[model samples]
Target chain A: MTIVSTADLLAILPELLVMAGGCLVLVLDPLTAKDRKDWLAYFSLAVLGAAFVVGYWFMGALTGSPRPAFSGLYVLDAYGAFWKLLLILVSGLVILLAKAHLKLEEIDLPEFYAFILLSLSGMMVMVSGTDLLVIYLGLELMSLSLYVMAGFKRYAPRSLEAAAKYFILGSFSSGILLYGISLLFGRTGSTTLAGIRDGIAGLPPGDPILLMAMGLLVVGFGFKVAAVPFHMWTPDVYEGSPTSVTAYMAVASKAASFAAFLRVFLEALGGIKESWRMLLVAVCIATMVLGNVVAIVQTNIKRMLAYSSIAHAGYALIGLVVADAAGTASVMLYLAIYAFMNLGAFAVVTMLRRGGLEGDEIDDFTGLARRNKWAALVMLLFMFSLAGIPPTAGFIAKFYIFMAAVGANMTGLAVIAVVFAAISAYFYLRVVMVMYMKEPGETAGTPGYDVRVVASPAAIAVLLVAALGVLILGVFPDPLIQAAQSAILPLK
Target chain B: MVPIFFAYFALVSIVAGLLTVSLRNPVHCGIALLALLGHVAGLFVLLHAEFVAVVQIIIYAGAILILYLFVLMLLNLKTEERYFHRRHAWYITGVGALTVELLMVLLASRFSGAKGPATVAAVEEIGNSTAIGILMFSDYLLPFEIVGVFLLGAIVGAIVLAKTPSPADLSGDER
Candidate 1:
């Protein structure tokens, strides 16, 4: 008898394509001529496009019921498909963003493309995994690639420092996660979601072992999503890494982690909602309050966005606290919109490079409006969107999340989130204020500073796609909302 | 007799673990690690997980410990002047308290989880390695395959981060 059937192969076709593409890129990296290394990025884009097409094609089969594959270790469903499509889209945009930024940073190794593809495959596996072991392995694959990419500029001390800190902390978090899995396995005798649910069905609500395992899992996932107390490495790593890698980490990695986070919590642990909901509320409030409050004091733009991403993770956690179908759908909508606006913001940051100086500080935007009006305009759009201003996607993402909270009788949590949202607006708008209000060469630290925007075609394309996505989703969100609604059915 | 063996392995493993961390000399630390791994493997064997026990000895004790020794010898590492600082007193206290609390909780809680099919009799019937092989290839095929990609990524990352930079790469940096 065959161990894996044709259906199993078909279920993982997209992931296989991405993995093969990554290997192909790695194999061709040294063979490709130096001047033609750009072809690798294009090839990786093609690979992602192919995977997207395949994944989208499979969405039809995944709409109603979840299909278990590989002896139920993996599942094919609209929830996974939705996140996979979003991840593919984000990775594609990141590749477009990276192409020009890598050249500007003088770290244009073709292995960068390979790592992106490999990490994308890991994310695909993560979203689809039905077993905790599979998810952990996928997380490792994704993180190892990112750890390397974060220090792609190997000679830079800050880059090396970022890589070392991230690797060490990330491994510690993974160990914690594995320990949680082991505890869970000891309590339930299984690692699969279905098995664990069944195993814990008869357990008391406050069973010490079960609660401990759940708490550890929350801490593990909290670290991955960079929620508040576990968020110490975010600002440093984001500030030190290349802009493109930071963008990928902030958008794609966060989205994938949130996807897995939602799956494991809602599907496996949904039975004990009351027990976990209070714990999540505490974490959610702390994350939002600390992330938004601390962000107001950051001098570097990357550090500000890192905190902003942390705050966004908190907003998404509100959905987990609500613990309903609406809550899950709201998180999907929020992350999808978040990917657009955050990437748009980072694309602009990536383009602010000129000569040897990395213009990553808030002061770099002192006179950006005068230097490049169009660039300043897009940055304005992204900043407004991130700040949740009306007529932008961020507002809509927050609206759905808070609406879900209120629907679930979490009005108090919703109110607290709205207040933090209001507070977060101050820092986001500061970039806009500096860009439009300040005069060229007005800052005292440097004289005759020419803030040129390196607007390549690829970067412009990414900006356009992201800007259009943010605007279109804000105005006409019916399709995505409906998609998210259907996507949560299996979990319910 | 079984309880006696268990006590000996557990005690020695804990002591070696502490020594691995607290030892001043790197080589001595490596040796402590080897003892710790061996005792851990012995404990695994006592639990009837012979496959894991043997693999642990082969991988951790044989391969990984050798690697640690090679790296220590290559660096020609010296004994540290000071292992602990006065400032770390609070940290040590905090960690010790947490460990004690955890131990208290573990000892108090009763673990009555659902039992698996891998009893000693069944393991003896099917053999440990064969049972593991069947499970790995059948039930855990997907995770097993993903581990391949995971290790491949690790290798690529190790090479990318550690390999000497090419002339062209250095020139690009200067430019």
Candidate 2:
């Protein structure tokens, strides 16, 4: 007989707004005129704007106090709020990119916006989820939505193949995660993250169930993060999925998953640091090495980005390896910066993929600097950012993570990560070399390459993100660093 | 008090699950899955989950199995048609099933409790649908709505995917 209070509703207003917006878009999709498919874009943009407004409202009250907003399911604190705010911002940018990208692909999908919101809703839940069960549920919600988004282009056989593979692999990972949860639940008799912390503290050393559950859970998360040995699905999936979906998956989903990983490992299981930290370091090292090396050989831009994502997961895992507030903060900063660089790159690539054809191969962009200066420059920015070169967000993100690793006295791992980053730079620089050094080849189907029509919206988003991300995080990094530090405050 | 119902239900359900996976014929698999669904419903009944049993029968047996059968009839599938089927589908399915058994062994060692998991509050109250529904509406409300949202997404995806006019071919036909 409990009455639903406005305050309670307001606590989850962002999630509610996202869900409502998604449904409203879905409902309004078919009822609209055909040329007005772009209205779906406007509707989604409006919804994200409203979500940002709500996030702003929440931020006004954020004195860094952690409140169990929904009877302890969600902890409304700086950390969760920070991730949520970024998620809201990223959701709109990706959606904005998709509107144009889908039109360029000649596939008018109003539902695409709705799906993005759904996935965004899932990520928000995951980042804010204080309970392990809620975490699993959010993870599934995100995974399922993403599975479809990957295969949205049903006409393409490869896309279908990619979807099937992703589905099977993702479901297997979910099973492993759930099994891990069951093991943890059996050992602790509690599913709450806070309760798990207490239960682990009470348990004896060399606890079998705790160790096993941790192992299984790490395996599960390792798949989502696309680290080594568990990353068999990444290249195929990234190559198979549409570029827009790939960008969202690579940046948004990975960020949210890492956010949850940070919360689960650092917050709940903080006491057993020595045990889990070793495994994470090993995984981090492996991911960094493999992602960079394999990416060098990739011909497809999507596959290369996929491998880069894996490497960045390695960078992000640096945050986990350190297991400190600074490390956590660096992760938040890295993720925000990454969304802009990665999504912007993909958005431009999607627009360039004209004539209902797939994107141009690496060769098609030969002398892109001559063909489309803006896109070429944007690509150069993305490449440099990803390569951890000077004056870009990517550099700052990598520096912060590496510095955090050094702070934790893991200079050896940090040094290894630096070497891999250097190796990764070779491939990224090669893309730039293709654009600037080489001549534009006899690449056919380059008709829809005007890019002025396409580049403005995507470029505006990408330039804003890539430029600001690189500059602000690099030049005026203190505020961002502080925010990143504060964002993890809830966990501690 | 009613170990017979529990035992019978568990035994039949397990066997049906095996049959469902093991059977080569699609229709037979549907029927086997149905059998499994029924036994699970019986277990629900024994566990004081009358509503769950009814819902289980309705959803699993009625809806899901029917869909399976319909798909089978529609596709006219001769066999499982799994990749690497011609080489060793039966053999692989056998090995795959054995591997699943091995996994069950591992899972039991890790997750299962002795005798019954009657310790949980949800278990002690009842396995009925009402308790689950109450939990869904009261505690797990967000997840419930999210699932509904997921279903909506799925439907939209299905429509998009199933809507077929080859753009390449259609371009020529477009007035």
Candidate 3:
């Protein structure tokens, strides 16, 4: 075996930064006083910021060829770089959101910040890895942190339930994924993407064993991304976890999983596209129909968005179904837009927390326009974007994905997606309508007039960034689309 | 001699595995699990994977079995007469069908397909442990380090979940 070289170490510069910073913070957190826990948030943010900078630096360095490091276990390429930046950006905003949230909810723990950074590191690793083993390990690292973060409010029984449900289901999925990987390894005699590609090419088309492994892998990744038939845990987990954690799970975790998902399928298993594409098409249809149709009846805002995010995953799978470079690029672009819009919507959810109020029920949003116009307006923008309304980034994302699907002769799937997209607008716009048109009711002991939901400046700042990102990407999508296309260059 | 030992180990493992799952008493199930683990280790030893066999006995039969016993004892649960859950007939059937399907497919493929290439002789020349160590430290250094991060996350998660909540945490915002 070759020795670990300096170049290999340099190739994972962003991950190294995250590890060192996360560990340093984890070590220092206990030594610090309890009142000073807020400092951990800033320190974690600094770590994420540093990692983002390193990722951008690497992206600049990724001009000609993707760099294979640690004997092809990981590849530092533009595709990985794009997802790394997105994960880091989403995580940093989450930490910002968490700071106010922890304070508002009175669960001041320094370990929460450390978990975020650790999880963020895992996400970075997941995106960069090309080997199945490395990808699985990265996924575990990411998921373990999230499981803890979900139950960060340990005093709350609901939070504990969420964490328990997520842990049981998540570990089950990991087992399935590992079984698939082992089966693939058995068939191919390799775990690396390139090796798997060569192995698949050597075999006949749609070998039964290889197809079985591919199916298991799809199910595993589907669970991670909250695709249907595997998404039973999403609503409960999302509704019960701390809202900031829910946001991270909804966007950052989903994006990171997709990053590895695209790599493994499009790179390693691309030769067997016909074998896996049909399975994905069925899953995409089920996910869109179930997620959108179910979401319409949800009264709880978090549960509603949980289903909404599942629907969005279905739409994004449209891109994957196309199984081409443009399709992959569209998925990337859609996720970036999705990260902003979904995180922004969850940020508003986090803002609704006050003393003795959870603010998750859809009725909590009634007449929000009269009370907090700015928040209501931000909500409107995110809602419009999420529903694929014109002049919003969501629209452009859906358009690009649909166009890619059509270009690949998947117009039938695209039309079905558009119909589902239209169905999703009802639930998303209902939140808007409640905010603008409906009057606040006074039917309960808890007066609607005195529901003082306080949002910190930091929370408002996250919302502003998300709203601006969505609008900017919506209005001038050319640059981001081009970037997404460029990111797919190395993969092609 | 090897064939006879393999048959003995396989029979013991199969019986123990069945008992582990089918036993009504929790304590009996735990004991059965220990036997199953030990017999599985013997099978691994028969396959020349001595390192895995030893680790299996030490980890599964030794530590994990003890943990299971502790949970079982602490719970002191009665025997569950209903072998299957009442509300989960469909779930059980579906899972059973899928398992049977997977078993059939795997078995069919195993018998029909050509065997994989033999392990590199270099691995046998060196100890399997040494070979694995070298590859893990060198070729898979990145994943090794990432596992460290995963462990760290797990440690924090355990602490966060099990730690007692203070009065200050339950109260409203202090910021």
Steric overlap count per candidate:
0, 2, 0
Question: Where in model 1 is the C-alpha error above 4 Å?
Answer: A442-444, B79-83, B171-175
Spell out the clash pairs found in candidate 2: A392-A470, A393-A470
Q: Output the worst ten-in-a-row residue range by lDDT, candidate 2 chain B.
A: B110-119
Summarize candidate 1's per-residue lDDT along A370-430 as a digit string, tens digits: 8999999999999999999989999999999999999999999999999999999999999
Judged by DockQ cut-offs, the docking class of candidate 2 is: acceptable
Candidate 1 chain A — worst ten consecutive residues by lDDT sum? Answer: A442-451
Candidate 3 lDDT over A1-492, as tens digits, reads 678899988998888888888888889988889778888888888988888998999887885569998988999898899999999999899989989987777676888888888888888888888899999999999999999998888878888899999999999999999999988888888888998888888887757799899999999999999998999999999998989999999999999998888888999998998879999999999999999999999999999999999999999999888988889999999999999999999999888843376688887888888888998999999999999998999999999999999999989999999999998999999999998997665556432444556879889899999999999999999988987888884543
Residues A265-309, candidate 2: write the lDDT tens digits.
987888788888888888989999999999999877888889999
Candidate 3: lDDT of B10?
A: 96
RMSD of each: 1.8, 4.0, 2.5
Q: Give the TM-score of each candidate.
A: 0.97, 0.88, 0.95
The CAPRI class of candidate 3 is medium
TM-score of A-chain in each prediction?
A: 0.98, 0.95, 0.98
Q: Count clashing residue pairs in model 3.
A: 0
